[model samples]
Target: MFKRIFNNQQPISLKWKWGILLFVTLTLFGFFSSLIYQQNALNIQLNQIQANHQYFFEAAINYLESMDEPIQRTHFQSVLDEANNNDLNNTHDSTLEFLTYFESNDIVYRFFNEKQQLVYETQHINLNPVEYSDSLKRMDVNNQMALVGSTKIISENTGESVGSFQYIVMPQLFDDIKSQMQNNLYVILIGIILFALAISFLLIRLFLRPLTYLVNSLDLVEAESLSQLRVRKPRSTDEWSDLSDHINRLLDKIDNYVKHQKQFVEDVSHELRTPVAIVEGHLTMLNRWGKEDPEILEESISASLQEITRMKGLVQEMLDLMRADHVDIDYKDEITEVYSTIRQVFNNFVMLYPEFQFYLDIESDPDELYVKVFRNHFEQIFIILLDNAVKYSTDRKEIHVALSTSVTAIRVAVQDFGEGMSVEDKDRVFGRFYRVDKARSRDKGGNGLGLSIAQQLVKSYRGEIWADSVLHHGSIFYVEFPILSDTRQIYKSKQIAKHKSL
Candidate 1:
C-alpha cells in the first residue's frame, strides 16, 4: 500500500531526487546528533553545578559544626523570625553570622526542622517551601533557574537528625553556554543544507554533461546526415567512455550497412539493364525483319534466349543471397559431415568438367570429420566455389580441392590455376555483382553473384571465407568451419554404418 502511494507521487528527475535524498538523510542524521549532543552538554553542565553546590553546602555545614556552639531550635527560630522581619540589630549568633556570609556570595540558604517545616531562610531572597525528597531538585526561584541541594543536619554526639539544610544557586553561566551552543547549531544546520544543495547540483551536472552531449549528437542525426552523428569522446576511461565507444561502433555498422544497401540496388539495376536492353533490341529486330528472314529470325531468337537464361540465373542468385541472410534461423541446429559433402561436390564437378584436372586432398578421416551445417547448404557452398574454380582455370585447366582439420575447425581451400586476379579484384571478388573481368564475365554468362552468395552462406554457418590471388598465378578461396565435437563424429559414424549394413 505504501509502495503504491510512492509510485503515484509526482515524478521527479533522477538527479534532483538522488541529491535531495542524500541531503535529507545527512540533514536528519546531523540534526538528531546535534540535539543529542546539546542535551548531553546541558546535562553535564547541570551535573557540574550540582556537584559544586553540594561541595559549598558541605563546607558551610562543617564550618557551623566547628563553632563549638550547640544549635538550639528555639534560638534558631527566634533568629529566623528576626531575619524575616528585617531586624538584624540584636543578632550575635555565630551560626547565623556564618550562614549570612553565604548570602553575600549569591547562595540562598533555607533551613527546615525535623517536622518538615521551614524554620529559617535568607532575608535577601523570598523562596517558597518545597517538598523535601531524597535527591536534589531544580526550581524556579525569583524568576531565575536555580539548583536546590538538600541534606539532613544531625547532632554529632547523639547521631540524631535535627533539621535539614537547603542551598539554592542559579546556573547563569551554563545557561549562557547552552544558548550559544543552540545558536551555533542552527547556523551549522543552515550552512550544511545550503552546501548539500550546491554540491549536489554541481556533481549531477558534472556527471551528466557527457550524456547530454551524447543525446544531442544523436538528435542531430538524420537519414541524410548520418556522417554528422559523432559523439564527443569522454575524457576518462570510465563507463561513459565505454558507452561512447559502443555507440560509435554501432554507428559505423549502420553506416556500412546503409552504404552497402544503396550500392546493392545500383549494382542490381546496372547488371539487369544490359540483358534487358539486349532482349528488347533482339525482339525489336525480330519483329521488324526477322519474321521474313529465317537467318535473322534464328539469330534474334537465340540472342533473346541467351539473355533470358542469364536474367533467370541472376534472379535465382539474387534470391539465394536473400535466403542466406536468414539461413541461420532456418538451419540453426542442422549438422553435416564435412568430408562427405566435399567429396560429393568434388565428384560432381569432376564429371561435369571432364577435361579439367581436379585434385582432391583430405587430411582428416572422412567418417569422423563433421561440422554444424545443413547437408544441402553445405554442398551448395562447395559447388559455388568449385564452379568458380573450374570457370576461371585458364590453359592449365587445373583445380585443387583441399580439406584439412585443426583442433578447432575444418578448413577447405579451392584453388584454380586461372587467368587469376589482381589484388584489387581479389579484395572485391566476394562483393555483390562485382566481376574482376566484366566483359569476360558477361561473355561467359556470369552475373558475378556466385562468390557473394557463397560468402553469405558461409557466414550463416558461422564460417569464414576469403580469397588469396596472384595476378597471373590464379586464386585460392579458403573457407573454415568450426568442427563438431568427437562425440558427434562417433554417433554419425555409427548411424552411417548401420544404414549401410541395412
Candidate 2:
C-alpha cells in the first residue's frame, strides 16, 4: 500500500474510491449471506426433527384413545388399584405396551378376563407412520386429549355387540417445537444481513460524491492551454478546493515572473552599454584628430581605455555565467585516475599563485583508481575553488589542497587560511552578483559570478560543490563526484604522486 502511494502519478479520484468501497461492501454481503444460508439449513433440519416429535405425540394420543375409560367409582377404584400396584411395572412396561394395544381391540379385555373377570376394550389403532412421522396412519385430531372413544365391537364374554371405550395418556412435544423455533431464527438473521448491505451501499456513495466532482473538473482541463481552464467553484470548502485554488495562484505567479525576467535581462544590458558607448566615442575623436595636442590625446586615451576595459570585463563575466547556465553537457565518463587529475590542477595553481604556500595531501591508494566523470570538468571545478582560495588568502600566503577517493566517490577540497566570511554572507556566496566583502572584491577584481558559475558547471556532471568556513578561521571548498567501477582502490598512487611532487 505504501509503494502504491509512492509510485502513483495521477491524483486519486472519487469514482475509483467509490468502486473499491462497493466491491468491499459486496464481498462482506456475500460472506454474510453464506453464513446465514448455512444457519438456515441447520434450522430446517431442526424444524424437521420437531415435526417428527409432534407426530409421535399425536400417535401417543391415538393409542391412548383405544383403551376403555373407567366411569363408575368402583371401576375407577380398580384402575387406581392397578396403577398403584403396578407402578414399578408401569414405569418400564406401560409406555411400550401402550403402542401394542393399538393392534388388537380385545387385548385389554383379554387381560382383564384372565386377571379379574372384567370389562371392555373400545378399538384398535395401528401404530403406522403418519404425516409428520415415518408412518402412514391417520392421526386423530378432533379428540386429541379424549383418552377413549366409542367403537362398535363384540365382547366374547357377553356374546353380543356393544359400545366400548379405552384410554392411555402421556403429554409433551419438545422436538418439533424446537425445530420451528430454529427456522424462525434463520429468517431473522437473513433479514439483518440484507439490511446491512443496504446501509453499506449508501455509505459508500456518500463518501465518494465530492471526489467525483473534483475529478470531473480535472478531466475537463487541457495542458499547454491553461487559458481554457475554468476552476469551477466547489460547493464545499475542503482540502481539494484549497489545492485547486493554490495551483491557480501558483500558475499566475509563474507567468508574471517569466515575463519580468526577460525584461530585466534586456533592460540592464542596454542601459549599461549606452554610457560605455558615449565615453568611448569622445575618446576616439580626441585621439584621432588631436594627436599633436599631447595633453588631450593622453587624457582622452587613458579615460577611454579604462571605460572600455571595465565594459569588456563586465561583458566577459556575464558571458561566462550565461554559458554556464545553458550548457548541454554530457560527462564522457571513463576511468579518470583522480591522482593524476588532482596533481594536474594542483601544479597549475602552484605555478600561477607562486607566493601562496599550497600544502598537498593525496592519500595513496594501493590499487590504481579513477572516478567516473569527465576529467576536464573535474579539473576545472578544482581550479576555480583553488583560485578563490589563492585570491582571498591573507596576502596570498597560506592555502591547503587535499584529495581522496573512496569506493563510492572522490572528493577534492581546497582550504584557505584567510579572513573568512560571516554566517549570513556564506549562504549567499554561490548566488550570481553576490559578494561578501565588497571593498575587498573591488581591490582584487573578484568577479562575484565565479563561484556561482563553478557550481553550475559541477552540477552538470552530477557532482556537488559547497563552501564551509567560519568568520575567522578559514574557508574550505569541497567538490565530489561518483567513483568508477572495476577501478582498483589500491593504487599506482605514487606513479602520479612522483609527477606532482616534482
Candidate 3:
C-alpha cells in the first residue's frame, strides 16, 4: 500500500523535493535548539535553588548558635512569629532575619539536638536525613520533589557540637516556571516552523520560475516551428541566465541544421535527376525504334552507359562526403607522418600527369613532420587539391607544391596556374555541391564535392585548409596541421601494451 502511494514510476516533483528538504532541515534545527534551551534553563534553575538554600541554611545556623544550651521547639516558634511580625521593620535580629524567609516560601526547616533528636520543624513533611554537603540533595517530600540540605552546627567560642540544621525546599515554583516555559517554547517553535515553511516554498518557486518558463517554451517547439522558435533569455545574472543563453545558441544551430538538410536534399535530387533522365531517355528511344538500327542502338547504349557511369561516380562521391564528416569518430587516435604522405601523393600526381609541369619543394626534413591524422585521410586531402590543380590549368600547365614546418605546425601549399575564380566563388568554393562555373565543372567531371570533403577531413584533425584565388590569374590552396613530436614511438608502445593486455 505504501509503495502504491509513492510509486517510482510517478516520481516526485522538484518543488516538493525542495520543500521536504527544507522541512527536514528546519525540524532538526528546532529539535536541537529545544533540547539545548531546556538543559540550560534547568541548569540555571538548579543553580539559583542551591544558592538560595545555602543562604537560608547559613542564616538559620547563626540564629540557633546565639541561643543558650538545650534548645526547645518554643524557641523556633517564638522567633519565627516575631520575625513574621517585624519582617517589614528592617530589624537586624538574626532570629528574625533568618525566620523571615519562611513567610512567602515553602521550606521545611528542622533542627535536631546533639543526640540526633528532632527539636523543631516548621513543616510536617516527611524528608529523610541528608548527608552534610554545600550542594543540595534531592528527595521526595509529600509526593513532590524537594531539595534537602543539612549540616552539623558547631559553637564558635567553645568549639562544642550544636544541634544539626536541615532544610527541605520543594522547588515546586521552579517546576511551574519550567512547565510554562516548555509550553511557550513549543508554541513559538511551531508557529515559526509553519511560517518558515511557507516562506521557503515561496522562495523556491521564485528561484525556479525561470526553469518553468523555459520548459513551457520548449513544450511548444515542434519541427515545423524550429526555424522561428527561440527560448526567451532570463533577466537574472546567474546560472539560469547562462543556461538560457546556451539553449538559445542550441536552437540557432538546430535551425541552421534544418535549413542545410533541406538544401542538401534539393541539391542531391537535382544532381541525380539529370543522369536518370538521360538514361531513361536513351532506353526509351532504343525501345521505340533505335533497336532495329545498329548505329542508333550503339549510340543509345553508349550514351546510357556514360550516364550510368556518371551517376555511379556521383553516388560514390556522396558516400565519401558522408564518411568525411565522421572521420574523427572512426580514426580518433590515428597519427600520420606529414612529409612522407605529401611526398608520396605529390609523386603519384607527378607521374599521372606528365604533360603538366609539377614542381615539388621541400623546406622541411624527409620524415621529421608528423601530425595527428590518418595516413589515408592525409593523402586524400592532397589528392583532391592536386587533381583540381591539374584539371583547371589553362595557359600555364604548372603546379608548385611547397612543404614547410613551423614551431607549432606543418604547412603545405599547393599553387596552380589555373583560370581561378572571383572573390565570391573563392569564399564559397568549399560548400558542398557548389561550383563557380557549373558548365565547366560538369565538363571536367567535377561533382563539386572534392574541396568540401578535403575541408571536412582537415577540420576533423583540428587542422585548417583554405584557398586563395585571383580572377583569371591563379589559385593557391594551403593546409596546416599542428606538429607532433615523438608521436611514432608513443603510438607503437600503446599498440604493444594494448595487444599484451588483450
Candidate 4:
C-alpha cells in the first residue's frame, strides 16, 4: 500500500517530498503537544475541584461539630433540607434554580444516618445515589459522570461517629476546555503545512537553477561545435562555479587534442604523397622500358629502393613521436647515468664522423648523476642533437659535449659552431617535419622528426630541453633532468648488483 501511494514509476519531486516530511513531522508534534496541554489543564481543574470539595466538606463538618449536644441523623437531614429551601426561596425560583445552583457550584451534598439507611441528597430530577465506598470514585448519575468524595461526620462532644457527607462534581467544564484546545491545534497544523510546502518549492528551484544551466550547456556540445562551445559562469562563487570551471578546462583540452589529431593526419598524408608518387613513377618506367634495358632497370630499381627506405624511416620516426607521450609510463622504473649515456653517444658519433673533432667534459660523479630514464632513449636524444650539430656546422668542424650538475638536476649541452638558425626558425625547429634549410635537410636524409621526438622524450622524464643559437655563429642544445637522490642511486646499484650475482 505504501509503494502504491509513493510509486517509483511516478516518483515524488524533491520539493514535495521535503514539504510532506516537514508537514507530517509538525503535525505529529502539534498533536502530542495538544494532548499534553489538555492533560495538564484537566489536572489543574481537577485539583481545584478537589480543593473546593475539601473546603466545603470541612465547613459542613465544623458547623455540625459546634452543636451543644450529640447530633442525630434527623437533625442533619433537616439542616440540609432547610438550607436548600431557603436558597431557592431567596432567588424566587423553582426546582430549576436549585439545579442551576448545584451545577454552577460544581458540587452536590449528601448526608447519611449512623445506621447507613436513608440519606438526604440535593433534590434533582436526574439524581442517582450510589452505595458508599472507602476511596474517592466516579459514579454514573443520570447518564453523566461525577467524581464522589466522601468523609465521616464525627461529633467532637461525644467522641463518636455520626453519618457521612459527600461532594460530587461533574468535570464538564474541563472537557469543554480540552475540546477547544484540540480545535485550535488543528487550525495551526494546517497553516504550518501550507507554509512549508510553498517555501520548500521555492527553495528547491533556487538550489537547482545552476544544475539546470549546466545540463543545458552540455546539450549544446557536439563534435562539430566543440571549439565554439563554452559554459557560462554562474553569479555565485560556490561549488557550482568551481564545477563549471573544471568542465570548461576539460573541454579546452579535448578541443586542442582534436585539432592536433586532424592536423597530424593532414601532415602525414602530405609527407607520404611525394615518396609514393616517386615510387609509382619508377615502377611505371620499369614496366614500360626498364625490363628490356639493363641500365634503365638498374636506375629504376635503385630509385624505388631509396624512396621506399625514406618512407620506412619516416613511418618509424612518426611511431617514435607517438610513443614518446607514454614513455614515462613504459620506463618509470628505468634509471641511467647521464654522463655514461652522453659519453656512449659521443664515442659513437666520433667513430661515425672521424673528420670532425669531438670534445667532452664531465664535472659530476657518474654514479651520483643518475636520472630516471630509459638507457636507450637517453642515448638516442643526445645522438639526435649531436647528429644535427654535425650536419649544420660550417666553419669550426668541432663539437663540444658537456655534462654538469646542479643541486637538483643534471644538465647536458652539445655545442656546435654550425649554421645557426634565425629567431623564427628557432621557434619552430622542434615542430614535426619542419626544417630550417629544406634542401640541406633533404640531402642529409633528414625527415625533420628528430628534434621533435627528443623534446617529447625529455618532457616525459619531467625534463626541459631548448636550443640557444645565433644566426651565423653557433647553436647549443641543452637538456636538464632532475637527478635521482643519492640514497635511491645507491639502493638501485645494490639491487642491480644483487640481481647480477643471482
For TM-score, the strongest prediction is 3
Q: Over the stretch 1-502, how does candidate 3's per-residue lDDT look in tens digits?
A: 3474477766677877787787778777876787788779878877787788778777767766665554556666767666568654666655555655554456767788888889887666566667786556776766767778887777666677777778777667667877987897788688768866887788788978898998887887864488777777777788998999999999898887788778878988999999999999989998898899999999988988988888888888888877887888887767777777887998898789889888989875753556878788899999999998987899899999998888899889999988899999999999889987899889989888899889989988899999999988889999999887766655774585468569
Worst 10 residues of 3 by lDDT: 95-104
* Colliding residue pairs in candidate 4: none
Best by lDDT: 3
Ranking by TM-score: 3, 1, 4, 2
TM-score of each: 0.73, 0.45, 0.86, 0.69
- Native-to-model Cα distance after best TM-score fit, residue 241 in candidate 2, in Å: 19
- Which lDDT values do the candidates have, in the order given? 0.79, 0.59, 0.80, 0.77
TM-score pick, better of 1 and 3: 3
Better by TM-score, candidate 4 or 3: 3
Q: Clash pairs of candidate 1? A: none
Worst 10 residues of 1 by lDDT: 63-72
Error of 1 at 175 (Å): 9.1
Write candidate 2's Cα lDDT for 1-502 as tens digits: 5566568865665554665577567657665765677667756854574455445444544443443432223443444455567653454344235534443332222122222223433333332221222222223433332121223333344544333322322111323444555676567656656665575667767655555665665576544454445455566788767866876676565655465456537644754575478676866677578778888877777877776776677677677666654443433323366787787888888898777787999786545556655455566677778878877777548888887777788788889988788888788898765678867874676656678768877776567888899886779988887765553432443334455559
TM-score of 3: 0.86
> Better model by lDDT, 1 or 2?
1
Pick the winner on TM-score between candidates 2 and 4.
4
